[model samples]
Target: MTSTADSYFVCATPRTGSSLLLGLLESTGVAGRPQAYFREPGEPMWAGRWGLPSTAGYDEYVRAALAAGRTDNGVFGAKLMWGTLDLVVDRLGAVHPGLAGHDVELLERAFGRTRFVYLWRDDVLAQAVSWLRAEQTRLWEADGEAEPGGHAPGYDAAGIEELVERIGEHNAAWERWFASCGVQPHRVRYEDLDADQTGVTRGILAFLGLDLPEGRKIAPSHRRQSDELNAAWIERYSRESARS
Candidate 1:
């Protein structure tokens, strides 16, 4: 029931610029978008979401990914959001009862020599605020309405507190898991990656163990699509976390 990822995996908290990071990795020819369309006949990996490809239909995809790892062509990576991680955790947990308790470790053991980039911002309240904004966007998108261009509304004390606690728990969970594995995961702060493109990108390239191609400009605006509406997301989350 549990299926180990045969290639590299990118496991990180959502809204941490994983998409932008994926774009950068793909640009370097090392990462590929997931074919989440189908898992097997009549079963979709992503269900009806985004028209991603099914696993069974992705035979060449797996081969290409494995080849990319063995050869020096590029770093083969897949972006694993919390949703994907949860799915894998669910499936794997069925196979190994306690796998949920050690999701990161099980993943590392499954994919030997695999690398992970765990991106996080230091401001806890800000992350909460961002999460709120993302939720609003999702609701709007699902309703087939236009995305909100500004903050929806201020958070109540209970809302803010709940958000901070939840995010903090998620952060703490991954931090401890990474430590237990004895794998020094590469970290990228959102602010630093935004402020210093060249340095952050160089660090990322180094973590991926790939040489930076000469004169390739790492663009500054290449992060996940967060708009002005989400500005309060990080701020609120950081503030709430600090208070607690």
Candidate 2:
């Protein structure tokens, strides 16, 4: 049987393997076309790309998204970073006044029978390292290659430590929000996803009550970015942290 939810949101923090999961889900062809729709910075870009009027309001944008982010079967999906949730909720309130102050209700009103998938990293240190590198190099993915002469980001112990703490705080905030809404999100761990990506994805599809067609393939869009430099940094951080 399929999950009652016709829509789902992937709630995640940076470097939590959410991107990989989204890609895996999209490959199934039955799952919704998940996208980070509500990130404020990406709103205008998406709006213009979707051919919406420059003066379009939140409701119109959301309508466009509902059409764009769904499969033929009508399961809609979106992504939400913890930091972006508050602003998104406020704007959603403008479009749905009666549902304001009730985040889950607001979402259900906007998108029918919504569910949440919480993706988080098990190793904060490793996650922070990845996030730091992405932020510094501005190379979040292999497709977005840098200029030929782009320099590698050097190690910054303090920066990494700060990011680790921030990621924890964001994770905790997500927990609190879930608690406040009496929500028990489907939990996924980055380390587990990395170890057995296909299996993990199958489990999630089961959770969503989605059945991969017989003989359907689970394909990853991109390879993991971890490399020798990541390993070296991990070792250096371990040694330095132990001394301190």
Candidate 3:
């Protein structure tokens, strides 16, 4: 059996119920979400906090915690959404192209001690459309009212397509990087989690080496559709379903 000293890394794409997973972990006191990066308790932003490291970087942060010598419990875990794979990989490549090669040596050297949790959504096309609508909603809400430029500003047909491609490329690169690292990550399907809570939660617990509290329910929100008659705007944007 892997010792309790083993740590964990939850690596996943955005919109994969990572927040709910993290929330469940938090309740156990065995794992914690990074306060500085995760920001407020429940607000979910894809990369705003999760991708931004402290001055020392992500691996350094985990290393520091380990160095603190506080292991009364078992492993410590943190999440990094896979949507950030491209952004981080590209940046690493610019500094040292070799780092992007087999094993992502730079990253592994920093975080290989962690057991990885890889989360993916099956309906990737729908995920992209959902992201577009969310972004548009944010812009509209930020304006404190409706602007004259339709549902979303500057996000036309071409823009949506680009976003979809970007997300797809990021997902591909994420799988590739982990494979090259020789890391057999624990894979979690978003649809499965939604459909079978008992099974998905058990899988996650088994991977993390943790037990669940009795009567705890695992409910993850993957669908963003609103059912009210007054939610026409949200419906229109989400149901557009025009891939890019």
Candidate 4:
């Protein structure tokens, strides 16, 4: 079944401040609940939260996700990492008969004329360090979510360098995907959001053709995860990379 809801996606890479963007968007209460709706480890958790049975089919999961995710204003949004885009498309096709066997064509079929927002980080080194630390600690966010327990392992230069290359590759893939699909996404940089959260979010609302009440402002719900540790790792990794 084709959905009539206005939909958009935040096409992102890891450690690109997507969590912060999603929080700011949700704060508007009109931008829809943008999140990693198809991410693993969280998908099953969302299924349980949405009250779906273990044996529920993909269609049922899609319906539940949309029902829970769409805002009252009829806008639905989701954050998609390039890594999981295929899985999302496959599941979407399973539910929407008209969307089968097409790459991005399925997106329009499932969510009528979807818009895309590309969020990326300019500082790849910092992003790589942040991703590595988060993976080690399993603390992807800092919004009072339960601490995953265990100290973050000491940084390894090789690991950070590998992640730097991987992040670059993934980001390049996103670029290629957009180019091949012939879609121009509204671009947002992590640095811009970090500098002015409210202004950036308002700009996004305007891009989406949505209006907010006069004088309305919502602070981001989550804190930036990067800290001195990230800075230190970046310095260490840069030195190692330069030496090698």
Candidate 5:
């Protein structure tokens, strides 16, 4: 199948439904296997998982990531969080010194015909609440797996407020970078994705110029993590924030 974009990255912040979006895209089997390959702190761990030595150079890491992310049709996908954008770009610069000063060109050199998908939540409060809970619980997704050291998450309005600010800052950074690059990413809102998982997934395939195979079904790999307590936190934050 001829693809419009050879590679794509899901640009996102935490608690933005990125896992769900990536899962839906991956389920199609045409879209690349999107995962967070360049998270700065997790670089060493990812390298280990990819069979790359800890001392592997940046270029080698990129190669492994590309090979791991690409589908049989030669389409590559990855998730790029705002926090790790700088590290990825700086490393890419080392590989291509000539394009060191150019972020977009640097990306294109490594990942051909690259596209960006901006995944975010419209409701900051809800996003913040979800992020705080995930951090405390160590359960980032509902995939029946978890990072080590998980406990029952507790609610704290102050913590939620801090995350709300951080989330906003990260999002703004993404906007600034996009504007600087003059690149308009495909925007996917968490609410819209949650409401119409199949519709949103189809829209992304259409954007990529790939048709979902007839009879292929899209299902979220992870269940929704939010619950009544999450709702209460959001509501409480709204009330407290409004009063403040």
Candidate 6:
């Protein structure tokens, strides 16, 4: 049976302000909790937290996901990266019937008239720097979850350069996928979201056909991870990139 819940997906890349957007969306209390449900590295951790066996089959996993991921307003949201899109779709189809074919067909079958949100960063250099720093520090989120006393590694020029190329490739892949699917997603830029989170959040809610609750306050649960170090790295990388 097809679920009657409203469904949406955030097509994003790393260091693209997706976490911040997700935090803002969840704060609404009406918008569903959007997250990386099938991210390979995070799947085991999530399964444990959800009280499922690490080796649980696709059907079991998806059932738990539907149970835990849906919000009170019957909205189901998820964030997807281009790299894992095929794998996630394949697994979802294996467990959930009618989602077993092409990308657009699967999405339509599984979610039934789903909405798409495309989130991206225009500053590739800054995006690469943030991405590299997070990899070095293993501090993906600024929510006080990072292990204390780990020395923040110095920036490596080569690493940042490599990441820049990779991030660009991933962003291009997202664009190609959208074009192939013939979908026009609601776009949200990282800079715009960072500049005015509340306004952007409201815009997203309106796009999703959700009304903000009266007298409710929305705030981000996580802080920006960029700092002085990010600025320095970006500057250095820009100079190096310019020379090469």
Model 3's TM-score against the true structure: 0.60
Deviation from native of the Cα of residue 96 in model 1, angstroms: 9.4
lDDT of 6 by residue, 190-209 (tens): 99999999999988888888
Q: Model 4, 231: alpha-carbon shift in Å?
A: 1.3
Per-residue lDDT, model 4, residue 242, is 83
lDDT for 107 in candidate 2 is: 83
Find the candidate with the highest lDDT and give its number.
Answer: 5
TM-score of each: 0.63, 0.95, 0.60, 0.91, 0.95, 0.90
C-alpha lDDT (0 to 100) for residue 76 of candidate 3: 57
Compose the digit string of candidate 4's lDDT tens values, residues 124-182: 88888898888788788876453567465588887887888998999899999889888
Candidate 5's residue-wise lDDT over 1-244, tens digit each?
Answer: 4578989999999999998888999999999999888887677887888899868898999999999899998899999998687888898898889999799899999999988889989998889999999988888887656678888888798899899999999999999999999999888998999999999999888888888888889887888888999999888878887899
Model 5, C-alpha of 64: deviation from truth (Å): 0.8
Clashing pairs in 3: 12-82, 161-244
Q: Candidate 1's error at 170, in angstroms?
A: 0.6
**Lowest-lDDT window of 10 residues in candidate 1?**
34-43
Is candidate 1 or 6 superior in TM-score? 6
Better of 3 and 5 by lDDT: 5
RMSD score of candidate 1 (Å) = 7.2
Ranking 1 against 2 by lDDT, winner: 2
- C-alpha displacement of 120 in model 1, angstroms? 0.8
- TM-score, structure 6 vs. true: 0.90
